[model samples]
Target: MANASARANSVTVENQDVALLKSTTVGRGPISDIAVDGDTVVTTNFGDDSIAVLDSDTLAVHGGVFAGQPTTVAVVGDRAFAAVSSASYDAIAVIDTVSGEVVKEYPLSFNVTAVVTSADGKRVYAGRSGEEGVDVAVLDVTAERVGTIYVAKAADATIDAMCLDTTGRRLYVGVTDSRSSRLITVDVETSRVRRTLEVGAPIRGLALGMEGVAYVLTSDIADGGVLYVVDLVNNKITADVAVAAAPTQLVLSADGTRAYVVDYDHVAVVDTEKRAIVAEVSVGARPSAIALGSDRLYVADYDGGVTVYTVAASTPMLYSQFASALAVPAPRELQPAV
Candidate 1:
C-alpha cells in the first residue's frame, strides 16, 4: 500500500536533453495549484483532500494538512489558507505556519475553487462555485466569517481560477461557461462586483499585472487555444495570443513583462509588452498548473510529476532534469519569517 501510494504520488517526464534539476513530488494526488514563498512551496492536492508543504530549496516534503479536497492555496506571513471542495467538507482550511496544524476552517455555501490572502495577512478571500449562487467569501484570520459578497448573474457561474493585484483590494475571478466567459472584478471590502468584462469564450485561468492589466486564458478543447489580454483600467481586450491545444493555466512574471502558459503538452511564453508568442517548450503530458519563482517556472503535470524550467537567462533553457518522487507531508509546523 505504501509503494502504491508512492507511485501514485510520483511524476515522470521525458528526457529534456539539458541538465535538469531533479523534480520532486510532494503529495499523493493531483496537484491542482502551487504557491511559493521563499524556501517553502505550498501545493493543493485535489485528489487527496490535503495540502502538501515542500521545501523549495531541497525539493523535500516538509509537511502537509488534510484541508479537504484542496483546489487552491495562498500564503501570507505565517498563515496559509487552502480552498477545499467536497460534498462532505467545503471550507477554507487555515494553517498556522509555525505549528502546521489547522487552526480554523471557514465554512462556505458552495465548493471553493480559489483562495487569496490579503497583503497585510489579516484576511482571506475565497471564491465559490455554489449550486445556487457564485460568490466570494471574506474571512478575518483573527476572527470568523465577517462578510460575503454574492454575484447575482454569476450565480450559476463557475469560477475556476483567480488572481489579485498588489494591493489586495481588488480580486479578479475567471468565470467559465459552456457558451461564453467573463472576468469579474470584486471590491473586497464591499463584496460587490465592481465590473464584469465579457470575453467571448470559456476563461479558465487568470493572472493580474501591475498597471491594472489582466491576462485571461481561453480553452479551445476542440481546437488549440487563445489568450486574451485585458486592460482593466480601460476595460477592453488589448491583445490575443494563440497557444497549444487545451491551455489550462497562466502565470505572469514578477516584473509583469511576460506571461507563461501551460497547455496539454507544451508551455508557451508571451511578451506582455509586445503581446506575442516568444517561445514554446514541450513538457509533460497534461500540464495542470504553474508557479513562478525568482527566475524559474514550475509546472505540475497530471501524469504525477513536476517539470522545472529555467527562465532567467536571455534564452530560456531546460536546466536540471526530471524525476518520479512522491511523498506529501502533513501540515504541522508553521515557521515564522525571520
Candidate 2:
C-alpha cells in the first residue's frame, strides 16, 4: 500500500513530443479529480478515501487528509471541498489547506460524481448520480447549507459532465444514456433549468468556449467518438469534429483555439477552430481525469499514476486561463452530476 507521503517516480518525455514532463506516484490506489492552487496540487485517492496535497513544482507529498471514498474535489483560496462516498452514506468533506485537516462534512443522499466552485469561492455545485435524476446539489460555502436542482427529470438518464460559464451565472450539464443525450443549462441564482438541448449521441465529456459555445464529446462504442460544437445563442449544433475512440475528457486552451482530449490510452490535441486533430500523445492504461495549471497539464491515471506534461510556450496559452474561463477538472464517473 502507498502512504500519503510516499515518494513519486518521475519520468520525462520530449517537450514538443507528447507534453509529458514527469509522472508521480501517489501511493497505490485509484486517483480521481485534481485541483491546483499556486504551489499546491490537491488530489483525491478513491481507493483509500484520502486527499493528498503535493508540492506543485517537486511533485512531492506535502500533506494529506482521510475522507471516506473521496471521488472529486474543488479548491477555492485556502480551502478544498471533496466529495466522499462510503457504503452507507455520501458527504462532502471540507479541508483547510493551511492545516491539511477536514473542517466539515456535508452529508448527501446520493454519490457525487462532479464538483466545481464559483470563481469567488462563495458557492459550490455538486452533481449526484442516481435513478431519480436529481442532478445538482448547490452549496453555499459561507452559510454551510445545500439545496438540490434537477437537470434531468427522467429516471433513466443521469448527469454525465458539468462546467460553469465564464461569468459563473450559468452552468452547463450533459445528461446522457446509452440511447440518447441532452445538454441542460441552469441559472445559478435560481437553481432552475434554463434550456435543454437534445444532443443525439451519448455524451462522455464537456467544455465551453467563446460566445456561448459549448464543446460536447460523444462516444460510440462501434464508431469511435466525435466533438460537437453547439451555439448556445442559436440553440443548435453548428459543427462536428471526429476524434479517437473513447475520448474521456476535454480541456480547452486559454485562447479557446485548441482542446486537449484524454482518451483510454492517449491524449488528442484538437485544433478547435480548425476542427481537426493536430497531435496525439500516448499515456497510461486508464487515464481517468486531467487538470490544467499555468503551464502544465496534470493527468490522473488509475494504473500508471499522475503524469505532468509541459505546455509548450509557443502555444502561447495557459491552462489556468482556459480553466478559469470554462472548466478545469474532468468528470469522475460515467453518469456524473458534475
Candidate 3:
C-alpha cells in the first residue's frame, strides 16, 4: 500500500535492445537518494522527512521510518544512517531495517549534506556544509561524532559532493567557493589534504571506480556540463567528457567500464575507457538518483516515480567485495593525556 498522501503508478516500455520493466511511484516526497542493501532498496524522502524500504524486485513498499527531513542515507549491515538536515534538529537517524524504527539519533554541529559509511562498518563519514566552513565528521560505531576533518577553511566555501576510492586511504571531496571549485583528496588516517584539482564548477556528483579512478560531474547552466576522469595516482584530470545539460547524479557500473549519468531529461551511458557516451535514453520528467540490480536500472524520478529499466546483464556487484576493496584498518580515537 502506498503512503496516505502519495499516489502510485507503473509503466513498462519494451524494445528489442533495452526495455523499461516497471515504473512505479515510491514515496509521497522528493527522493533524495537511492541505496541497495541485499534484496532491499531504500530511498530517503526529503519532503516528508521519512525513509522507505522497498523490495528491489517488485518495488513494493516494505516499510517506512521517520528520519526528520533526511537528505542522504548510508547503509551498514542492519542499520541505515540517514542525515536529518532540519535546522531545529540536526542528526543522523540510525534506523534498523528489521524493526523499521530509528534506534539512534547522533546530533551534529552543522547541517549534514551527505552521509556515507567507511568501506568497513567501523566509521561513518558525514559531510557538514555550513556558512563557516565545510567539514567531514567522523563518527564511531556508537554514533558519536568524535572527530572532524575540515575540507574547506573559507567561510563561504561548501562541500558539494564526496566519494571514497576502493581503498579508504583516499577520500575525494568536492568543494566550491565564490572564486572556484576543486576536487580535494584527503587521507583517511591523517585527515590531511593530499591533492586538489581545480574543476572551475560545482561538482554535483562523484563516483569512484576501479584502479583508483574517479568520475567527477561538474555543471554550469550557461556553460553546460562535463564529466571529468581523474587519475588518483597522478592527482590530475585526464579527460573531460561532455554530458547532458544538467547532470545531477552519477553511478558507475560494477566492473567500472561504464558510467550512468542522470540529467533532467535523459540518462547517458558513457564508456569509461573511451570517455564518450555510448547510449542515450530519454526518461521523461527530471530523474534524480539511480541504482543497478536484477539486470535492470532503477531511477528515482521526482515527478514520474521509481522507474525500472531492463538492461543487458553485466558483472554482478558484490557488496562484500566493495567493502573489502575499500576497507581500511580502523583508526583509533585520539585520547587526551590522562
Specify the highest-lDDT model's number. 2
Sort the predicted structures by lDDT, highest score first: 2, 3, 1
Q: Which pairs clash in model 3?
A: 166-326
The candidates, ranked best first by TM-score, are: 3, 2, 1
lDDT of 2 by residue, 10-44 (tens): 33333253445666777567787787766777889
Clashes, model 2: 3
Cα lDDT for residue 206, candidate 3 = 86
The TM-scores of all predictions, comma-separated, are 0.81, 0.85, 0.87
Task: Please report, in order, the local distance difference test score of every candidate based on alpha carbons.
Answer: 0.67, 0.74, 0.73
- Tens digit per residue, CA lDDT, model 1, 255-313: 66778887776677777777777776554355678877766667676654565656643
Cand. 3 Cα-lDDT = 0.73
lDDT of 1: 0.67
Better of 2 and 3 by lDDT: 2
Top-TM-score structure, candidate number: 3
Please give the RMSD of candidate 3 to the true structure: 4.1
